[model samples]
Target: MRRLAASLATAVLAAVGAVAVVGQPAAAHGAEVFPGSRQYLCWEDAQTATGQLDPANPACADALAESGPNAYYNWFGNLDSNGAGRTEGYIPDGTICSGGDRGPYDFSAFNAPRTDWPTTHLTAGATYEFQHNNWAEHPGRFDVYVTKEGFDPTEPLGWADLELVGSVTDPPDTGGPGGDNYYYWDVTLPADRTGRHVVFTHWVRSDSTENFYSCSDVVFDGGDGEVTGIGDDAGTAEPPAACPDEAPGAPGDVTAHDVRATQAHVMWGVSQSGCVTGYDVLDAATGDVLAATDGSPMVDLTGLDPGSTYEVTVRSRNDHTGAVSDPTAPASFTTTTTTTTADNAAAAGACTATRTGASACS
Candidate 1:
């Protein structure tokens, strides 16, 4: 599961209101790999030797055009920084696949209604080995859901159309982080399930409020686990040059303010020569991207460890090139051990990470 998020880089945590967010994670994530999710399949469908967007499928081509190639490049990152295991009502109806359209990259275009999405052929009522990628390993639970019988593939998916099938808590994981390695498990498809349907996966991390969602288009048409609609037969030709020169340069004037028990605000100056789609907030100590935000110049980092000091850096992002700038000067802040209205999440009632770590209010 190269589970990258949509282009909505901001890690927004809107409950009944709104909280401004900018930037998101570049790496350190995961997604479904066995029954390939739309992003995964689209990435596979469009992955070129040149790292450019040239999909053979119509749906993948459209998604690449609308959401850009980074949607597939960082493919395993479609996660929300503030999900907290909340589903259905919290994630809305049609946008379930994109984690309510909140995460590091733009995956909203993948929610489009199309049946031609590269599909996996499987037989109904079969016990199959399931695999979820561990591109970035974290302790978590993987919930498996499948669409109900007589499901319509041409319409936007809604929660009502799905039924929880199985779940595994921190299942056995193999392979190293940042590789094809994955968490493996066994899933028995519902015998009643047939025809066109989707296998939805929700990966809820135990250590944080972050959650990764994957939507795999599949059919129980009496076939094995053969995938269709992707063309890599001819293989590598002279690859086209991707849009890398347009990658944004490093940002500067980085600063953090409004520090609190579980939150801090990061701001930076972007004077790059090219497009700067968003910023990635990173743990300066680990170099792992903590969260992603929109194109805004500032972002609020929530869910900090109280009384702990942290140093962070901001890296400018270019979604088109999937390139991130060098780290801006590190900015440091310490979380206040004391609780506050912001930390309490009085109105929003949801929070992301700060190190960024995950914390949620009751």
Candidate 2:
């Protein structure tokens, strides 16, 4: 395979660890030839051609030698090479005429009476990908046309024509002109439609010639299904121990601090067993668990009387095992209140009257 070339800036960027590049064209267009031999033959009528062979003609033997079993190419001669002087340089006129060669290549063998046509079975609502494996005759980019079995091959597989799909270039390993290039297209079947579907792929060359081939590897898979949960309810068997656990662990390092407006802030470090499920905030004063969910780290308490103290704590929960972790140490904080001089004097007077034990004038 020829190495695809890259731009200097691209090379420099890759060297600097910025980006990775792939599939660059190594040489200019048409710079390289097909890797192997080009000449091949397909017989029109093997029985008639065989009987017509003249035993006296040595050229006929060479042509016959080149035409192997099933009338495929016996040798890869320089048929398409530009250096070959004959028009359509690769296949020679002498070989074509001497061995009963027709003006165009014969593909009758691809159809029945010669060989069985390839069959493709597709499922409903599934996307199918298709490609061609051989690249000898059809080089350069091409379009694949599909149609119903009863219609002419030239007719397109229109909207009502069952499911006509195109594929990306066949990968080089699969025998595309470019090494192992795969042409692909996504096709989906109607929900209610099922049964046998016939698919055909043909390459339209630069000369507007159509070279047809049949394949059976196109496949279909049903569309996306319902969403699935990932925990105990998910029905899948428990994974190995190495997998993260859902249970919560012991809590630690509880701390409480003051905030404005009779509110206090609570913080704690949650310990996890295997995996941290989530955390919970609790009202320490009433032993009431306030918030319960995963990923919340802090909570605020409000509406308390000024100069009053309050306690807060937090606990963690695990998602996988459905376990709740131990609570963190309790912490406390006091809220502050504002007072004027008049209010202080009134408070002092009330305290003095209460201390004197006098039932003075009401």
Candidate 3:
């Protein structure tokens, strides 16, 4: 989970008092992770040791043949730029899984209804932490729906067959944008749901008209998020557990700067409560503490390897209540490397200083 930190800056532009002046066409990426979305898991399955896309699942093969690898490469792009949260009346029934094929890529082939396409297993009425990848984070509301009982999986999905299972607005992300990071929330599955059912999620971005859609094939048959139908991992892949959503987790907007070969500085906003005794800097990937600060907003990280990337999240510790707040959306930094030769250093400095005025650094 190396950091590809494109801050969810647009998501919090209002708070920062900034206006977006984007010139290039903006595209976002993400999809449901748990109860693995069709596109998400297929993308995972297509990955091969030879760096080639070879899908093993029959339905995945059919989808690959129809849409090509482009759709699978951009599995998170099942979105509609002009959707603006309009559903039922706007997106047609058969093509709902593809966001009506209005996305930047052609994902129409994924809309085909199939009983096999890598599915997640769950027990009826069980509470589980649902996850949606935040590959490119955005401010949004999520509407999670599951198919009604007696819903036929062999036929294309329709709006009338779905029932609202849960809804959450702007949930907390496990880390910053990219690399297995996701927006997390607890969802209680309907008890009556059995057999083959599709868990559909509609993401309505509040900042823009862009909306994403995900279709997750699942069966409620007394299992624990174990997935089936994808090579040897058919029933071995277990869904990840959700991060705790505790309050007063040090106000967000955690940032890093002054990165160096072995040192860097990270800072964030203050906590809301007086019970916060200190702060802990945690590795965003494993949620392990790397450093601690004595109630300081900023923490200096040292002993980092040169030219290596690290992602870290911050948390507030309340000694009085014996409570620890949730980690901040991760801040990623890569340490810089230095050369021994004086000539190399001077060349590097000159290349960096006025290189901004020139097109090439060399």
Candidate 4:
């Protein structure tokens, strides 16, 4: 029996609502941190000296404001420096900065909006994979930061909430003067970490100053036997269906033999199908449809003038879905020769005798 192939399908999930926080922040910390909380922070020096944080500013503020704290950033040109501090120390435009157009600084130049800080609902003990693909024209690399919500940018190492995992350089095949950059990090979710973790995909500029651009696409598979909703189903699309099953048909067994002087006998298996519409006999050499039958086997090749070889193949079609089966193996045969008697008339008319000559023909 022939096996048929089935179609392919995809499974999709639904989206969940934003998380809400209920408690107040401690006096030492500023605000209460909860799951799903999101915000932005910028280098203080860049904001003050470059006036980058003001929403009204055309270049710095506007560009920084549009980016989410969790978003990824891409620094322009080569601005290699060290450490994140005042903007002038990192940014090229900074007057106090010693590095050319770039300085070494920490979360000082630009940050996400304070109110719209991103909230992370990641659970501890679960593993997550962070992937980044940079198809940018120039060399681009980013750093991943998982910090606590509502952290101060001014304090040294204050933003180092939870280092789930980090990759500062571009992955292989993503670096160099050409080509895109790709990076990914796999980390086991912290058992102590829960509700509203701040996930940051920061672009590490040449200068120590870094900028945050986009948030990570969070996906929760399993952990602690607890099912916490995280991923969005509305955005997920189902995979397209697979190809339809092939139609069934009788195994094609065809045979051929020379007949008479210029004819040949061709025989093929009668097609049997639950949905067989028709069957076609094709000349294997020329691909021409020699004949079409509702569902019969066997055909005669006449008027061939003998001593000629021919090849034939057969195929069946499904009536319901219009699916056609592949052609069967070809069958080949040569026509037999014909002969007439001479005056001697002994056995001169025999096909073998005629070739032997008059004495044999006689």
Highest TM-score scorer: 1
Best by lDDT: 1
lDDT at 72, model 4: 13
Query: Which candidate model has the greater lDDT, 3 or 4?
Result: 3
Model 3 ranges off by over 4 Å: 1-25, 233-362
The stretch of ten residues in a row with the least summed lDDT in candidate 2 is 23-32
Give the whole-model CA lDDT for all candidates, comma-separated: 0.70, 0.31, 0.68, 0.33
Q: How far is candidate 4 from the true structure (C-alpha RMSD, Å)?
A: 29.9
Residue 175, model 3: Cα distance from true site in angstroms: 1.0
Residue-level lDDT of model 1, residues 255-339, one tens digit each, is 8766777667665663335555567778888988776654445556666778989888888777776888888878888888897
- List residue ranges in candidate 2 displaced over 4 A: 1-245, 319-321, 338-362
What TM-score, to 2 decimals, does candidate 1 have? 0.63
Ranking by TM-score: 1, 3, 4, 2
- For model 4, residues 118-180, the per-residue Cα lDDT tens digits are 223345555554434322211234545464544333332223343635554544332321112
**Candidate 4: regions farther than 4 A off:** 1-110, 113-121, 136-143, 148-157, 160-181, 201-362
Better of 1 and 4 by TM-score: 1
